[model samples]
Target: MPKVKRKTKAKSKGGIFSRFRDYISQYMTAAAAGVTVVAIGLAALFWAGGYFGLLGEQVSRMTNAGAVAMGMDVRRVTAKGLDNTQRNDILDAVGPVIGSSIFHFDPHAARARVENLGWVRVAAVSRLWPNSVHVSIRERRPAAVWQMSGTLHLIDENGVVIAEEISDAEYTNLPLIVGAGAPATANEILRALRKEPALWGAATALVRVGDRRWNMRLQKGGDVKFPETDISNAVRDLARLHDAYGILDRELEYVDLRDPENLIYREAGADETIAG
Candidate 1:
């Protein structure tokens, strides 16, 4: 009789309530997984039946309507960096976004449409809080006027056509490039001519010959035939010749600088070629 020390048993920690909670948790977890699978199957069925797009569109419309009801509709659109690009063009590119819900407006599509314009080099479109949309853009800088097929087009530094059918009086200071491939190759010769201010000032237009070489139409009334290669050196030599012997000042029919070592010219009324 040791006072009956082992007579009583210890109670279980957490008792029956803990076990009940665990059982309920497992049951609910399995039910939730079953529901998720059913939802996934329904979604796949909708996709296979070609109703997914329509369902998504309906959901989007509902969401947009709800947002508009909450005063999230676009009321004003602001634009920046719109020098050469017309305001109307920007508005058209963004579509009828003003009366629509700001949350439903697609900025990427608007940007793409804006960038499709000839003058817009790059564009950005975005929503501004609850009731505004914003647009930003950078425009191409015109480098020259290209003349082809009896039409005039404005071109940028990279020879990308900015605008077509331009008037003759517009941008009179920009150099005119002639022939089919002239715009693509005008930068090299134009840059070389720029180094020789006198030559650049005398130049009326640059003509691409056979898409290989260039011939400069001079303001003084003659043409200068340039070699296909070593254009910079040839231009420098012509500038030197002009400075030394007044070669460009004379009344000449044409100047041929195709040969690096020879300078040939023909007088306005002479048939013979003169070498200097």
Candidate 2:
């Protein structure tokens, strides 16, 4: 009988990956050491370049390039809560980082620029991850027009100056205040006047006198003088008198409420006095 021919087994040729795994396992520690040495050398080179200031120009370019490649650049800028602040001004404040990296942007610096604008009262700048910048601004509201030293300035309720050299035609309807310290004390007088809608509506302006007291100008052509102390009580009394007797509706030149206990009124172009 002929013996059966035995089939020879084919020699196995491991793939490239299998060979690579074997190589890495055998020299794993040595490979790690080599990588560490290369990293140290690169770090040293960067430090030397920075110490000599040779890396400043290249560093920014490289950072920007890398950031762009990594999709970390600013792709959009948005402004919120803008009323009188022009859109161009807000864009100018954020112009520096329009296409730059959000990582390199300074939010504080941007916020300061926005707040320096004429209408911005409070501003906040922020970076959205990967590619967006957001700026929120609170614009100053014109509460009154303050006249001092022959100039008019727009002021907010908190006594802060919003704009100077404002035109009367633009803000003709707002309450007008005159005097050196009028802006600072304007809110108090305005608040007191709000208690009496009829009186407040009939009035036009409030002038600070000697930085101590106030003089209110009526729409119908008269002046109302208020005392330095107990102003609220004085205002209450005036409101009561006006409501009960229609005192303000009369043709009066001036009403002196400086003395809360006494109601003094003088007619227009009249020497006689009317008291209540």
Candidate 2: where is the Cα deviation over 4 Å?
1-58
Best by lDDT: 1
Off by over 4 Å in 1: 1-45
lDDT for each residue of candidate 2 in 1-276, tens digit (9 for 90 to 100):
999999998766777779899888879988889999999998898787685366676788899889988999998889999878888899898777867877888889889988988789999999989899999998988888898888888988988888879887768878899999888887877888877788878788898999999998987889999999878888889999988988888777999988767889897989898787
What is the Å distance of residue 214 in model 1 from its true position?
Answer: 0.6
Model 2 clash pairs are none
Residue 144 of model 1, lDDT score: 95
RMSD of each: 5.3, 11.5
**Residue-wise C-alpha lDDT for candidate 1, range 71-173, written one tens digit per residue:** 9999998999989889999999999988789988999999999999999999889998989989999999999999998899999988999998999999999
Cα-based TM-score, every candidate? 0.81, 0.75
Per-candidate local distance difference test: 0.92, 0.86
